[model samples]
Target: MSKIADNIESTPHSDLAKGDEHSVKTGRILVAIATYNEIENLPILVERLVDTLPEADLLVIDDGSPDGTGQWCEEHAKMNVRMHCLHRKGKPGLGSAIIAAMQYAIDNNYDVMVNLDADLSHPPEKIPELLEAWRLADSDSTVAIGSRYIHGGGISGWPLKRHFMSRAINMYTRWLLWLPMADCSGSFRAYPVNLLRKIDFDSFLSYGYSFFEEVLYHLKEQGASFVEVPFQFVERQYGSSKINMRKAIVAVWTIFRLGLKAWNPF
Candidate 1:
């Protein structure tokens, strides 16, 4: 178990000095979302999250987008103490951004953490259910994934090729890495700070889109349990996708490399 997880598991949510959990009726939570030119979506997403998880704080990890996303994050943080923003020097890969967010959560002593896209495809309303899952489980190692492949879960406003590719990615990772997850490529996830801290970011492998699956595989190896919550996944309304055909191809190659390395670690 991570030291942070150990601290939270032994300590009750009522004891946190930062924000009280009773308002949200959940633990001392931190919601993390990575951004790169998400100005159009970030504001509405942040507002909805504030209302949904009243007690939980939201962290925006901005990659210094040309858009004023980082500036908005700073200004918004002034008004709402619950909002925190981290501005990177440049646009790093998705994996690095997520790792940074997880690090911040661990450093700040939050009891639970949820990571979703800035695009609002992962509804903030489903947050309660994720926290509920953690509450029911006896271990702080429980991770809840907002899955689209699970029963009662699916996507909307996605092209057939995109949908098919998503399914194929899951199948590929599930078979190669032996992952039990149905939505290996999905970014909507909830994790305990302790469990996330246990991951070694120093030697972290993979980049770009493959980062999500790489994380799931490592977490499973560490004995962390998972819960899949079905939800409607929607396409982004604003901003073009950062992923390109070249990155997609590289992600596949990286996955195979990661799988082999894990299976036969030297």
Candidate 2:
């Protein structure tokens, strides 16, 4: 049971995650997804996840989405013990939501944390690939990145502008921050609980898309080892993207700020 607030809701799913069922006794894994108005995607996503990785625990951090996402999660959680939801006051930044997720995972005594998009773009089926990578990582490994720029990774259904923007942002960050890895701008990542506990998340720089890049840089700089898993990036099937010109501009500028901070950590 979760040691969180009273509003925290849970129930036993028809399928159990423990005992003589699963072939692998993967320790407590929390798939933390942050959501705003992911009504259309959440249901199907949860169903597939429950069927796919029944052993994984799910935590949904909803930012007061008026679309009844909170209520929907509450209802589904009633039947699914693995499902957990955190209701925030309003639409907080994605970075803040992720911070909340990290705290939740640590507080609840989970071993591994995979934070990804609530939309199906991140692919729930590939979750085991991530966990497998994490499992195989060296003792020093703390983060595993779902990279789209690697040899076996690519993108599908993205507009030319989106592709160009993604490539450009990564290129910009690479030259400025000296990141050798591809796809630092992406959100699909896994972190070990003990490793994440060592970082100072309060000092995270970006609150939007750049948050992905900033944290990547910070973790690498802190001597954390990482593994890259190639996965195709896909466009969201439902709802509009939240990124706007303002967020993009902020992301660009944050890259330089990150670079400067790296140069002089004072």
Best by lDDT: 1
Itemize residue pairs with steric clashes in candidate 2. Answer: 11-81
TM-score for all models, in order of appearance: 0.90, 0.89
Q: How much lDDT does candidate 2 score?
A: 0.79
Cα TM-score of candidate 1: 0.90
What's the CA error at residue 229 for candidate 1, in Å?
0.2
Across residues 1-266, which tens digit of lDDT does each residue of candidate 2 receive? 12222333333343323322333336678888889889999898888888888778888988888898889998988877778778877565887778778877676667788988988898888889988888887764558889899999999999899899999989988888878787878889888887766667767777677888887787777777778899987889998788899988988888888889877779
The number of residue pairs in model 1 that clash at the backbone is 0
User: Taking the candidates one at a time, how many backbone clashes does each contain?
Assistant: 0, 1
